[model samples]
Target: DATLLHSNGLTVLPTGTDNDITLFGPINEIAPDAGIFESDIAIRYFDGPASASCPTTTAAATLLRIEGDLIVPLGGPATSCILQGDILTVEYTDPTDASGDPNTVTDSATFDLRNGVLQSDKSVYIIGADMILTVIEPDWDRDNDGAETYDLDAIEWDSDAATVTMGNAGGEGAAFDPEPSSLRETGDSTGIFQVVIEIPNTLAGDKLERGEEVVLEYTDWGPSGADYVGDEDEDINLTIFTSNFGATVELDQKVYSWTDKVYITIVAPDHNFDSNLIDEIGNSAEDPIKVATRGTDIDPYKLVETGTDTGIFTGEVILTGFTAHDADGDGVEGDASGTTAGVGPTDGFLAADDDDGITVSFEFSEDETVVGSALIRWNIGEVQWLEASYPATGTGVVRVVDPDMNLNPEAVDNFDTDVWSDSDAGGIDLTVTETNEATGIFEGTVFFTVTDESSGHRLRVAEGDTVTAEYEDNTLPDPYTTADELDITGTSIIGTIVPPLERAPASGIRVVDAFGNSLGEISVDQQVQITSDLANGQDRAQAFAYLVQVQDDNGVTVSLAWITGSLTAGQSFSPALSWIPDAPGTYTATAFVWESVDNPTALSPPVKTTVNVI
Candidate 1:
């Protein structure tokens, strides 16, 4: 259009004829419309010195202006105005990201804002608790100045009760109206108003139920009654919550064997209100959780928080089967049964049998309790002998197969059994354990030990005696016996005296020629026999290792051989290993005997002789 001069004197910095700034005719103009108008403004510089900042250029001088036309429809100024907020964007190069294009960011000082905003401090409010519904009217503070929540003199409520309709979520319950004049200011001149709604907790008279929703609807009214809506309404939806432990317990495995470690996980939503993971419940202290093999005698177990703000807890408990008599029958056992707590690992020692039930419970609060259960089964265990029979001086190997037993490859799962001569009934206690949890096979060594003066677990018996190994399966009930035995007869049926071997070498070794003769002289390309005359000098059969080594004149071994087998009582044998000579030289032959190749213990002094390989 055209430029009309107004008396608001606009001036430049220096007041002079050459420096004074003059108004120019408009290049583009805007007429108030329904939508926002945007454009840029520029200043035309005339007759500027030619320097590095700006080079001399002869361009036509012009001016331009950019603006967003504002329009208020509710009323005129003083009564209502548009709450406008804008963002000035900029793009610049960042040294840290040189290879990428220029980075763009929003101006932090400014953000988007609007009117008729409604919100609450919390998402869900517990039933029977106090709730505050906040309302923000940007038009009330359009000038950015503060306004009170309740203005008695203003025609805001029309001198009548403000009807803010409160209803259940999804229209589940009947609409309930809050108290009259419930509107109040949240802060001084904050322009934020809130209506405090008191929720009833009494189940008998309470109109709201757990899992229900709460909706707040508020409409502004001028001189009209609160029932009249001046414009669109502002509303918010929230949830009605209930307080309790509400935790779920899960066992890592559905089935477990005796003496196995039970892993437990408990997930309780909203349990930890704080952001930190330090919060705890049903812990070792306060109200300690218990996982008992029986119903009455609950044992204290340890549980800890899994992570920050997770509301999840994890723990591990060891099951003591019937052998340990760790159970809490049908009665109350640990502090889990009480309203308070107790210092404990487990108070009740009630024995648990196979197919017994395990009780896990905790006291979340004095009024609330959480309980869970699992199954404990211990099958009838069976034992197997590594051999059919054993000599009086031989060791016995007992392998127990019990799926009800927790097997650990690391050899931690261990249990005790007994073996004795059935004739004398003098039993010796032995420890058997599982290796390789996948296969529930346990093995232990039963040595034929000597009769020491003081005896605790000593089984001294001669040949022909029947050794009975009894596996006490505690899983069996009282009416049924728990003893399962395996009777193994001694190697000899006549009670004879067999030979016994030492832990190390008991005889000497020697080397012989290929024809089984003493080493003397051997021709090139001829092989010589190296042998050791070993005998079972004791009562029992013993394992033996015989070795023969042939070396050159410089003491470097050129040939080596060995023979391994068992030597029975009073048995004599000669083991020979051969060595061939390739070159004509003075070769030395040496033979040695040991307990076994695995153990290089010299059973006898090594003997050597020289051979002429020519």
Candidate 2:
């Protein structure tokens, strides 16, 4: 006689063998009306064969009747029965559900079963009409002023089938269908059903109050097809809280010139605690607002705290040392200035001040929405003091006039214009008439005119006042030669008496006449001389001359005269080449001296003397 045994107490089974079972029973019992005398036995049925030794079933149990002659074999049937287990307690407990507004709410439940024959591993199920979820917090109102309530109209059940359904009832929603594929025997009666319920975003409130809670109540079905005896319904409690806030930054002006006085004002409206503006740190004193700027044309400068008004803090900053060259010439400099104001101390805004000449105080409006007008002014006195002296020419007429209506002459006098005044003559107006042929002195006539200071009208000077004009040769060193004018028949000569042979052993030639000087008129053939003493050790030198016809702006030159020869070193030679021009025009006679006629290594630099051919 075979006996049904508990799956957990299966030590009675044969060990180390397949323990295959063969049942031979009567097809029909002799007792005619007894309904074939079938004896139903409880046994474990695995969807597939048990992996462990026979008799130790890893699957749930099913009832099988033994009345007819039947043969049971492995791998032939999808379901097979092993030994049964003693009945044990099965219950559901620990349901949890939570949500944050605008987000999904997740609900879960657990089934606890102990010491029982779990006939169907898929015993856990949720009742559609039994799940009740509600918002517990009275102040958790989102849609209306009344109490906020959440119904389980939209519910999602986590199972092998992953079934979802909708209901109109308060919390009575969809039922969870068992997933057979997910069923497996756990130690002959110990198994758990974990139910995951999801409330979609559609049901979640568009807005939710902070510090609110939700309660979920649901009944779970176990193997007996009844509500869990100990805990008829599982209750899940969940709380919600705030997660995020808002902040913003604004500015007064988008663009500013380097010299513009920018007004920066920072206002934090959100910082208003109670009726007054105060940060979380509790300091009511105008919050130290930091204003920073970033751009390409700006020099580094510090944003110093100038003062404050109302809840807005004020700071001054100057954009100095503009590197942009003003290529567009818009008068207003072109450079991008990006200013960002944040809540912080002034330490972060301080940088090494370059103190460039350009500076202006800037103020920003509260809320950074309006920028104050920028008044940029120059430090004229400081700038003029640092500037270099003005360059002056030997002879030029100076006319004084006031461009600005400000009658004060301080602006003009600051440029050292008074240095040109004649102390003895009261006021002097001199003109250059002619130059002396022998002494090379400039002769000029001088007169005087006085101006009525208030009306700026001219007046005659006192009769006996004599304004004598004198001259001094403050001629700075100039490269000679390259005469400005030359005569057709006149001789153009450039001479060098001494040579710096040690520094430049190789010789070079240059014109001795000052730039723009006339070489005299040339009516006929003219002689051009280049004279230079050769170095002491030089053996010989070669001289070359060319009369080049000056071209117009198109730069065309024609050789009028070409001469080349050799000369002895350490001796001065006058290479007086006769240049007879074919036409009267501006021409340059250039002379070159080389080491020798054949070798032609340069002994002197080329000298060009201009001649005017009439």
Candidate 3:
């Protein structure tokens, strides 16, 4: 029986030869039930010509006739329907019948025929009588597909390309490195790709404890084969700021004494967290991180006495296992005279049979000890006992022996050597007094006499050998408070001496103290600049008194030189400019105003401005 094809297929070649044509079989084969006609007839097919020659026999057609709905068989009923040998037609049956399933409608003679099919085996011009069918799978739903979420670290990222690779979960933990083609191509679109990175809580537990930064880098390569070379790679950095769960300790001062209580605090950056997240020991468990603060014990140490009269006393205290001292003891001295009766030692021991004559010991009160000295070690006993003392009397020398006598063993007078006298012992002479009054005013004078014991005459001490005067309440004033008062002020400039060709000239200022007191005066050599047009020093000086300047409190330059010669206070000076500028060069003219060099001498900064004599 001839098959009833649904659709047509064709092949058009340059020459309609037998081998140039293609063929397809009938697709809509049918079977029916009764006169009512039910058929497995969801069939569809393609139709085309069979050969290159014109149809000489029966003309092929996709027949659709039914015989009682059982077997609807049809084929080409005519022969020699003239057609061009080079033209073969193709047609299709049914809109969505790509698979040609045949289980639905019934077949009948009135059914539609899509097109003709062809066969080329015999070259008899069999046109459009054949059909073919194939099966296809159902479409898939992409949205409901299952996917696994992964952490940042769990994904393998190629640092070189700055890309993240997906990994398999609940398997061997294998990573899926996608090909470059898998990345979405960017062009007329915003080509931005992002990945979520989660930081681990265990890392940076001390600084953050709760917060961590999972550094993430992303890069993108431009499209390949673009019109022009592009700087396509892009880098993106992300940071997550978080809090720290730890303790902090601060101190009032760097050095702490043993008597002071060490202060500390224990707190977290955030107080609220699940209890399970807090770490207790080694910070492993708990919700929030736990913090503890402690301080070190300071050891109290005494000030060690280490020098003679008029010397320094050194001391130290250990704090937090660190050693610090009062800037190493220097310029130290001691006086054994004070507490001599209790702490001073004698010459030597005298045995039984010796009558070494009477030995008298001199002593002083603890309050009479010198300021920079101490009376220590009267006897080598438990305390090694020492006491701080100051100079009570005005500048006097205390001697260890008698005066006006040659009592030494080798003296011309040949006096006893055991006893202390002018010839045998040297004396310490003091001549200064200090007052600890709050006003810093000390009223005292030093008196001393140089005598020639043998001539019974008084020796003359040089005028400058000793000075006795009441220094009054002289002290350096506070720099900050006094600086802003009615005092001498000026400016400074970088000057150049043309005649000498010096890099910088001597430019200075003159100033005076609060009480019209002058600072040290400097009288340096001055020079003039020469203009190239003028011969030697012949050019007339054009004084620009209008071009002067001053500085404000914030050190900003301001035009305060309206009255050029007048600065702050009564100090003023004239800048003399008489010589001509022989060359085209720059020169600075400085005006200085200073006070007399008596008492507190004051100097002012130079107020100067450069003039280009061209």
Candidate 4:
């Protein structure tokens, strides 16, 4: 009996104790022409009788087709040529589904072209194309096993150009045979062939001139060596254009005041090559220009681009105030003049009338390119540039009157007092009393005097001349002093101390017995007296004593009593202290004087009265 098995192709054999069977038929057949002949084959089993048919039948197998078409799937019109340095792609597909699974059939491709002229080696195309070709292959099981796997492949374009080589997806050793003009079985499993070709500028010479056309033909060779063809030829055209760009800046006002608004315009010629206001080339709508004073230590201000018109950008930077100058060598301007303080006025003011005009500058930059310009303007001027000016003499007069030389209003006028006389003119002598240092207050006498050409007699102050007084306080204990110009006006000025000063009075204490008698010896449990007195001649008459201490023979001092009371000038206070001693010994008593409970003064001399306690 004869048997047939079906698979990708056909297979025939004899079975059932028919080892000596002779079978004649097609073994493997492909579409349209080759396949298994289901009826024509004859089989002879065991050499007994010749059988024209098989007892058992199997499925029929189909043939594998490896033919495909090459196509230029992407890029441009079929008649248009690609740019000199542009990319082109070629793909291949199967027309005949001979392999049953047409999508899984592997394929390859190759290109043949003249680098202007063909080379001696047919396989070597001398095209100065200097092309970089990348082949994308499908993942497949080359061994035809049940398990599917993939192999990394390499590509060699222009074997002479050692630098022009392509590595497989795994970047391992060469995956394709460089000797043959064939692409690897690389591509998706769709029986497709895909390859990208890049022509570098360095290789595209005058031979490939602008407006010239070049043709590239690619062929798709199936994995089984069957060839197919379709849109394999592609045309590439060359075109070129050059670019020239620059920029300039202009201001609405050449000279600006501190209160003025700075309007800036930037003209960038050829910035928009297409002449469209839109930012196509990324060169439009650049950063804003920086505006700053030429020689002032001020933070630079940015004039942001508010809008653009025909490649011209407009921006504005509003100046709130101008930088100050230390004209009087005091480290700050207008401090003594009361012109600009705190946030300062937006109206700019020069230190003096003769000062030079301030120079304002504008700076523009993009990337590494930069440009700048400057203009001079006065603080007070017309729309145009001008210098500041002031009068030679002031119009207001200033004087210091009602001098409290002794800091006492009730005292009569004394000849030795440092008094200020009513003066009309020439400079006056001013004095500052010694400051309390602790309270930060002082009194001074200002003598208004005038000079004469002949007699040098006293004169009254004239109008238009001003005298200003300034003071400095040493707030930080003994070292640092911060000065400030006092804002004073009118004829009489009286300044008071922040914390009033106090004078410690002279005090003395006397120790006496409790019986109102002067006793030398006293027994334990007996009482004694401590008398505290304030002298009449002292600056202050009142005095206070807070503590009274008693010392025994062993030299151990104990606080016998605590007194918190005040005493008037020439007044005496006698307080009874009864600190009974447990042991027989001699004891002495003393008192402590304090200017006030909060302010402590020197302790008064101890007034001792010896007593024997037994």
Candidate 4: C-alpha lDDT: 0.33
Candidate maximizing lDDT: 1
Superposed model 4: Cα runs more than 4 Å off: 1-511, 539-543, 569-576, 603-609
Cα displacement (angstroms), candidate 4, residue 86, comes to: 99
Candidate 4, 344-398: lDDT as tens digits:
1122222211111233232322343444443433221101001111111211122
**lDDT string, candidate 2, 377-436, tens digits:** 111110011111111111222221111111111121111111122223243333332122
Arrange candidates by lDDT, highest first: which order?
1, 4, 2, 3
- Model 2 residue 350 CA deviation (Å) reads 28
Q: Candidate 3: which stretches are off by over 4 Å?
A: 1-143, 148-198, 201-214, 218-237, 242-246, 249-265, 270-278, 281-614
Instruction: Return the TM-score for candidate 4, rounded to 2 decimals.
Output: 0.23
Candidate 1 structure quality by residue, lDDT tens digits, 506-551: 3334435655567556678776676656766655566778777888
In model 1, which regions exceed 4 Å deviation? 1-114, 120-136, 140-209, 221-247, 252-264, 270-307, 314-355, 359-372, 382-416, 420-427, 431-469, 477-614
Q: Write down the TM-score of every candidate.
A: 0.37, 0.19, 0.16, 0.23
Q: Candidate 1, after superposition: displacement of residue 371 in Å?
A: 7.3
Model 3's alpha-carbon lDDT is 0.22
